[model samples]
Target: MSIKFWRSLPFQTGFSIALGAVLLTLILSIAVYNQTIEKVVTDSNHRISQLISTIERSASIAAYLNNDELALDVTRGLVKNDIVTGVSLRSESGMRIISGSPFNFKEESILHFPLASPFMPDEKTGELFIKPNQQNIDAQAKQMGALLVFTLATHSLMITIFVIFLVQNRLTRHLTDLANTLHKIEPGSAERLQCPTLHRHDEIGLLVRDTNQLLTAVQNTLAGERRLREYTETLEKETRKEAERDPLTNLLNRRAGERAISRALDKADTNNTRCAIMLIDLDRFKPINDTYGHDAGDHTLVTISNRLTDALRKNDIVIRWGGDEFLILVQQGHDDLQISVIADKILATLSVNIDINTSIQESIGASIGISLYPDHGTDPSYLFDLADKAMYHIKRSGRNGYFIHTPSDTA
Candidate 1:
C-alpha cells in the first residue's frame, strides 16, 4: 500500500533481481556495439581493396599501349565510386601522370589498404604491371559510424523488453505480495504467514525460505517469554508468603515480628537505645500435663498462649518455643526501667484464672525473665539464652513471678 511499507519487508528479493538485470543489459549493449563497429570497418577495408585492383588493371592497359585517354577515364571511374576517397597514376620517376580530385597523393603512402598489392597485369593491353595508387580512410570511418548506430538501436530495444519483464514480475509484483503478508502479521497473534511459491531457481526463493524460518523462531521465543512471565509471578507470590510466616507459631509468626522489630530497631539502634527479649515459661506446666489429662492440659496451654499474646505491646513478638514455653520480643528498651516494667506488666497479665473450655476454670501463673540487647548480651542468641536460663532459675526458686538475670545469680 505504501512505499515505506514495501521497503521494510524482509523478503525484498525482487529489487535485487531488477538491479542485476539493468547491469547485465548495459554490459551486453556495449559489447554488441563494439563488435558491430569492428565488422563494418573490416568490410569497408575489403571493398576498398577490390576497387583499387579494378583501377590498377585499367591503368596497366593504358600504360602498355600508351593510351592516355583510357588511363584518365579509368582514374575518373574510380573517383566516381563513392567508396574510393583518393586516386592517382604515377610514372617510374614518381611524377603524377594522372589524378582524380584536387586531393594530392603524398609519397607512395598505402596505409588504408589491408595489404599493399605491388602491381596488376593486363592481358588486353599486354602491359607488365601497375602499382596500387588509391586509399579509402574516410569511407571506413563512415561505415563504422552507421554500424555503431544500428547496434545501439537493436540492443536498446532488447534491454527495454527485459526491463519491462523485470518490473512487472520481479520488482512491482513480488514486493507488493511481501508487503501485504508483513502487514498481516500482528504481534503476539497466532496467525501464520504463508510463504510465497518459488517457481524460478533464483535468489528470491532463498530469501523467502530464510525469512520464514526467522519468523517461526521469533514466534517460539515470544511464547516462551509469556510462559516464563506467568511462572515468575507465581514464584514471587509464594516467596512473599514464605517471608511473612513464622515456622513455630503458624500464627502471624516470627518473620512478621522481625519486620516490626526491624523498623523499631532501625529507630532505636540509630538513637543508641535497646530492645528486650522476654523468656517466659508456665510454672509447673509439665507436671500438670503429666498428672492431669494431657488433652485438658493442652486446653490450658492454648489459654495461656492467648493471655501472653494479649499482654504484650502491639509491636511485640509472641512465639511458642516448644512445650509449655513462650518467647516475647519487645521493642521499648530505651531505659533499664523499660524491661522491668514490661516484665511486671506480663506477670500481672498472667495472674488471671483461664477457663480451658474442656473443663472448669483453672488458675495458672508464669515465670518471665527480662534481658536487653547490648546490655545483657550483644547477640540475639546470647540474650535469648540468658533470659531463658533466668526464667528457669525463677521456676526452680518457687515460680509464679519474673526475674532479671544477673551475672551473680547465673554464677
Candidate 2:
C-alpha cells in the first residue's frame, strides 16, 4: 500500500496551532489567578481600615466619658462586618472593649485607627484595632480564579475544535486525494489529475494544471534524450573497438598490444614468473606483393594471423605491429626452455604454404625472435627492440629458424 503524506502532515499542522492556543490560555490563566489573589488581599485590607475609620468617633467619645458600654458597642459593631475577624478598642479612661478572635491578630496584620478629642482635634484620646479575615479573602480569590479559568478554557476549546474541523474537512481531504492520484501516475505516461469542481479557480486547481503541463514536457524530453543516449552508446563502442583493434586482420593494434604486454610483464614480476615476447617478420613478404599484387599480400597477412592465433594458447595476446610485422605475448612462459618451445611453434606454423587464390600457391616463411620478461628487461619498448634485433639476427643468418635475444645481439 502507498503511504499517505497529506494525511499525516496537514492534520499535524492543525493540531500544532490548536495546541499552541490551548497552552497560551493555560499560561494566562495561571497569571490571572496570581493577580486575582493579590487584588483580593489588597481590597480586603482596605475594607478593614475603612471599618476602623467609621468607629473612630464613637470610640473617642467613649474614652472621653470613660464609658464601657459605648466602647463595647463600637467594637462589636465593627466585627459584625463579614471581612472583619476581630476588633479591640482601648480608652484613655481605662475602659477596654474586645470582640471575637482579637488575640490571634498578628502585629503586622493589625489595623490601627487613632481617636481624637471631640473639641481639640490635636489631642490624642484612644485607638481602635481591627484584623481582616484571611480565609474569607482566599475563598473569594479562588472563586474568581475558577470562573476566569473556565471562561478561557471554554474559548480555547471552541477555537481548537473549529481549527481541527477546518483542516480535516476543508484542507487535508483535498490534499490526500491529490497525493493519491499523483502516486498512481507514471512519470512519462498519459495520466493526469482532474481538478475538483468545488476547488475550481483556487490554488489547488492551478497546481493541477501546472503539474500536467510539467508531466507532458518531461515525457517529450525523455523520449528525445533516450534515443540520443542509445545512439551515443553505440558510436562510443565502435570507436573504442576501432582504437584497440586492427581493421585488416582483426588483431590487437600496436598501442593496445603494448599496453597488454606491459601488464603481462607486471604480472610476471609480481608472481615471480617469466613472460616471453616474440616478434615475427615475414622473410620474403615483399615478393608476394611484388608478384601476386598487394591484395594477395593483404590476404597472406590475414591468413598468417589466423594461423598464429590458432597455434597459441587462448591466454596469449597477438598484435599486428604494422607492415609485415607481428608481436605476441606469452604470459605463462616459465623459463628459457618454455620460451624456445613457443618460438619453435611459431616458426613451424608460418612455414606452411599459402593459397593466393586457388590457381596460385606461394610460400612466405617467417623469422621469429623471442625475449623473456626480466631477461630482456621490463619495459615494453625496450623488450620489443631486443626482440627486433634477435629477429634480424635470424633474418641475416639462415632466415628460417628462431633466436632468443641476448645482451650481445646488436642491430
Task: Please name the candidate that would achieve the greatest TM-score relative to the true structure.
Answer: 1
lDDT per model, in order? 0.62, 0.84
lDDT of 1 by residue, 1-411 (tens): 455645643334445554565676567656765665556555655666677666665566455555668757766776677655455554333334444445533444332222122353222332222223234434454466556655655666676557666665765566567657767786656554454465335655665667667777888889899999999999998887676654333434554654555565566678777677777887756766776777768767776777777777566777665577777878754345477777887887776776655565666788987777657765566777798888877877888888887877643
Candidate RMSDs in Å, in order, are: 8.1, 10.1
lDDT of 2 by residue, 77-136 (tens): 887898988888877766678887856545777777878877788987877777777789
Model 1, residue 257: distance off in Å is 9.1
Q: Which pairs of residues clash in candidate 1, taking residues 3 or more apart in a chain or in different chains?
A: none
**What TM-score does prediction 1 earn?**
0.58
